[model samples]
Target chain A: MLALHAPASGGARLTAVNVAAEAVGLVIGDRLADARARESELQCHPADLAADRAALRKLALWATRYTPTTALWADGEAPDGFFLEVEGSAHLFGGEDALARDLGERLRGFGLDPKVAIADTVGAAYAVSRYSLQRLVIVPPKGMRDAISPLPLAALRLPADDCATLFRLGFKRIADLIGKPRAPLTARFGALLPLRLDQALGHAGEAIRPQLPPPAYQARLRFAEPILLQEHLIVATTALLEKLAPELERDGVALRKIGLRFFRVDGGVQSLTLGLASASRDARHITALVRLRLERLAEGLDAGFGFDTAVLDGLAVESVKTAQPGLAVQARALTEAEHRARLVDVLSQRLGAASVRHLSPRASHLPEEAATPLPALHGAPPAWLPPPRRGPRPPFLLPRAEPAEVMAGVPDHPPAQFRWRGVVHRVAAAEGPERIAAEWWKRPETPSTRDYYVVEDDAGRRFWLYRDGLYREAHPPKWFVHGLLP
Target chain B: MAPSLRPAAPPPLPLARTPTEALVNLRQTIARLEGRPVAEAAVPVLRFGCPEIDDHLPGGGIAPGSVNDIVPVGYDATPAALGFALALLAASQGPAALVQSRRLEAELGQPYGPGLQDAGIDPARLLVVSADSEADAQWAVEECLTAAALSFVVGLLGAPLSPTVGRRFSLAAQNAGHPLVLLHPHDTAGSNTADTRWLVATAPAARDRFGALGDPRWTVTLQRNRNGRTGQWILESGHGPHRFRVVETLADRPLPAPATIRRRR
Candidate 1:
């Protein structure tokens, strides 16, 4: 009584059929009205194509247990199945037959009706799984020819129109095409006819682009016995880093970001990632940084049963030239820089990386635009010019300028007194108004020009206040307290 | 001198010691019981060039290896406290680290490099770390304090710390032999294990040749000191050979505005 129907060209077609509906002689793609004629009463629901596609993608990712390379296979325009390149991976599960049986059994346990086949090529696998009466089929090398010969011409992955043309021409089975001469077949059906046939017969190469590729710089340690002690885990991590560091050094590269993944015996994975301020190849430095991170993540990493495998991956790497000894002083300086870099690496890992920042100068005249904070490891050393001597800048600049009421004698002159945060401050002394024009190219919608002044209150608290807009404008200028002079 | 090989005869001792000798013996006995050196060479201090300011502190100046607590007296007092800490950092010998929380950074704004340079601490020698939370900032501060490479560590906190956490920081500073300064931006109250506690308020700025605001000044009050001294002084930053100096002519402090009283309707 339960089925999801979509209106097709002819009538209401069953897009999805539930177990109860299928048991009552209902099937997907069947005319709903005809199915209803068979069953006196039937329940109908609407099909959600977007949700179905997302579910299929999730299932494809889970299929990675069988093979690292899995892709969605499309029936017409919709993804109806998954293609797994279990080429050399089947042996881990004993053999191809056992792997296919395990896959089918596991999927069936999850309420999925599965039809699986293992073949040498994608075309043969797709054809036999969908149309063959046998639930499972395993075709050996050069076995696809006899395997797909008796099937309909649609099994060749041809379009419906081409299939009808082939039927009218008395070519109803794949065997009919296998015996025909290539020149005549192409002259009638174009190049695609022979290309698809060759692809099915393993004469042409077919590639399956995987969803994700394995990391290039990675070392894995598999233990015969699971380890639960923190000290043992640290020892295993050190060993893995030692194995991975030499490869990086050979390639003239250093890792700036790395990840440690722990595969638990119960099939759960816990990962910790660390970012460094500079490129480093020293294994001791990496181990120290990872140790500090482990201290912080002690609660989340539950070695449920125990961890059996540990993998270290160089998530991000930077190229560097090998160091050659220079002058004594230069060598000392380099050593100092290296020490600082290591300290920054450990600190960045201890505190979140975003918390450790380095200042980089930006090419702008605005006070706020002069410099910016970037992740300590990611930013290069900053080069800055000497500050202007006209007036002293504040020790701290407000994140956002707070509005203040300014009273002054002249429109362009510095304010005599200002009220900020509900307290009034009388200006004991005043400085010149340095004009700062807004970046019109960047923010043309509201162009504003500021007139800043270094004003000290009666209590000697200096303030950097600015008039937001010029007095020469049609509207009166607004005042704001921008920064504080130490 | 070669003939004086025999021990000299002891002079006739007085029947009783004088009052001054008795007092000296009593002081020595107390020092022994307290487990402190009676006259330990003044703890090595970083001297402010200005004699007046240096003399104000016991042992002549700030103890560079001790924990100094700075409490802001008002909302406008944070800059003063920071300027004072920076001056101390400028006088130290090694690279300095500043650990600040996001809340503190957002409220008081970040430490500007050029401004810090102008204040006399070389921008190149400073490492600024912004933590996500107060606890993270405290942890970073402790960790940096234990780093032998750091000259000193400055931590900015939104609130006061419990005595236990403060003791941990004090112990860490002692172990690393590096100075530590904790800045409490808001006027929060709590007991701390610092050698000295100061309350810094904004004072009048110095005047330039043209009578404009020249440099920042702060009214530093010694709220608590283990050396048994409580005093207040007006000090200027980025001045003198030590980068800070005491102002002789203390500005007149305006009396607090009278509290309003409402009559019963």
Candidate 2:
């Protein structure tokens, strides 16, 4: 006999018990000492609620294979059940009965004994699945009222104290309150009984929040023989994309974001997401992008044993107009802009969108703030204005300025010599003191004004240096090497 | 002895209608024997617009579909090498890509936008790819070469590339008909299969009439050329985009200034 115990105010109490412990009459909430005395061979372990909750969540995510909408149901603290809204998806598995049976078989294969219930209403399904004698219950449409009428009041998902009060008032089963007047029930129970009854009878609607948002469009495939090779996965992906292509074309829509999920036989799931530079319904183009992402996975996909199911979902889609081909002798090929967009999509998939970027000019005098890096997938950048012909800027700019030691001839003169990066360079020629004041209007505190200079060292390697502030400040102005010039 | 018979001069070369056509046919035969794609006669060449430098290069310029390497002469000469590479890209008028490993970016500095504009290359037409490693950087360079819209691709690597990767890059560039320029540090020791290899160093800039700093100068040496002569020249940036002027040979001029010029306060 095995049991899990948790700390209680009085002492340690058994929170859960296995079949053998239950067979030996060891009930939950019993004192651990008493349970040990009742069954001398009983084994007890401490309960970890947090780990249980996380595992349950992972299991719920895995259940998304049956239907896109899967929610977790909790009774007291942690989730103990899953709700799959297989209303329209049941036909894919042959029927509601077949789906429930398949779910049971799969869960049992994972060493779990699951009780599944399919009903027209959430309240009725919850009551029958928990209190019914059979492990699998199917409450047909309009049969919810009769199916859950024999169960006890606790099956209504009411408070334990309320159940006791209703039992004390001679209301033992849900059938006792089926045709009773609501005014006395509301006055006696304060609206809980009437609301639960109405919900169970399919009069009041209930909504289940799914673990993940339902995809705009999705295609699924199940393999008879599990496969582990990457080539096979690619083939499967191509087939799935082909299936989705016709539908997308018919709807005149293109996918902006696609998610591919691999459901391994060992109950583990792996997912990859691809973002396109532009909306595309072309299967070949999207397949190529997916192949690039697959090749670049650092550790590769772990198909632990093998994966039996694959799902392709279009997470975000947009409507696109199809262009009619002109009656010309030759069909038109992709334009230059379209070709560039494809290249951007390929590079972004392999290296990541953030790594592939373009520079756009910003209206700022500060060198670093003069341009911003935009992701290439965002589209072509705007035309850049010609740089003002003030002084030449260095082709390479340091991420930040490094302080330098300087020896100047006059209080306001440029540096005669500066020591930077552990080397002292004698200045051969100097060109600046291009004073740029800080934007005081944009900030609460006024920053120090900079005096920039273009200096050439004796080696003919040019350096861009700047003095932090005026020489008359409390501390003498400091020098910093800001960039390297060609 | 046999009446000085030379087989009637091989039937006057029946396959040749013109000397240029005959040369092209022979070149194609040789290329097939080498298991390489036949070089097209119409491949575009990027000229330096300076007679002194252009005269030393084959076809009077560098081919757009060939791989080239630029190595800095010293640690301080990296910027000069970069400047020369950018001038080459600017000459090939179209969109370009710059690929570099993150380590290299940290060691050197990030390519500044304003500075790129100052070098006569428009910042908008350039794509920057920051790879995680040296291999990724090379891969990105090869991928960029496959794009027809890009005129050229440049990769700055801190580590030397293996010969196999270099050969692959050359083949890709040849097929795509795009130029590829690779920049290496002074300490890189591995050999590459480039059409031309240049060694660059900074030279003192000439002042204008008012005694202000003028165009930047570099002493560029053609250390290796597969099909042309190798030489060195002092070149400086010219007045317009993608233009350079040959200053003088090393023997024709003396050092402009001493190593250290300390003026009294």
Candidate topping DockQ: 2
Cα TM-score per model: 0.79, 0.89
Those runs of model 2 whose alpha carbons end farther than 4 Å from true positions after fitting are A6-13, A31-46, A74-78, A183-193, A325-332, A409-411, A439-446, A470-478, B1-44, B189-191, B251-265
CAPRI grade, predicted model 1: acceptable
lDDT per residue for candidate 2 within A1-486, as digits (tens), equals 899999997999998999999997989899999999889999999999788878888888888889999888765312477789999899999999999999989899999988889999878888888889998999988999889989999888777788899899999999987998899889977877788788888889778888889998999999999999888999999999998999999899998899999998878889999988788887888989988898999778999989999999999898988888789979568877777888889889889999999988888887778888899998786678888877778877888888999998656798999999899999888898788888787778868898899988777788899998887767888899988887
Q: lDDT per residue, candidate 2, B77-125, as tens digits? A: 9888888988887787778899988876765678778888888888888
- Give per-residue CA lDDT, model 1, range B1-265, as digits (tens): 5687778564333343886455445544564566534433433577777765555555566665578888878878777787777777778765778888888766678877666656665565677898877788888888888766577788888767988898898778767766688888646753378877888888777667776666677888877776546667777776436587666423333344567332211
lDDT of 1 by residue, A1-486 (tens): 788888888988998877888787788889988888887778877788778877877777556555657788765523567788888678877899999997788678667888888889888888878767787788877899999989988877788788899999999899998968899778888898898888888998777667546456887776889999888888988899888878998999998888777867555567787878788877777888877787778484799988877878787899988976566764324455666677678788878677777666677767887767777676444655666664556666778888999998667988998898899999988887888889888875987888888887887677888898877778898999877776
State candidate 2's TM-score.
Answer: 0.89
Give me the candidate number with maximum lDDT. 2
- Fraction of native Cα contacts kept in each candidate? 0.45, 0.68
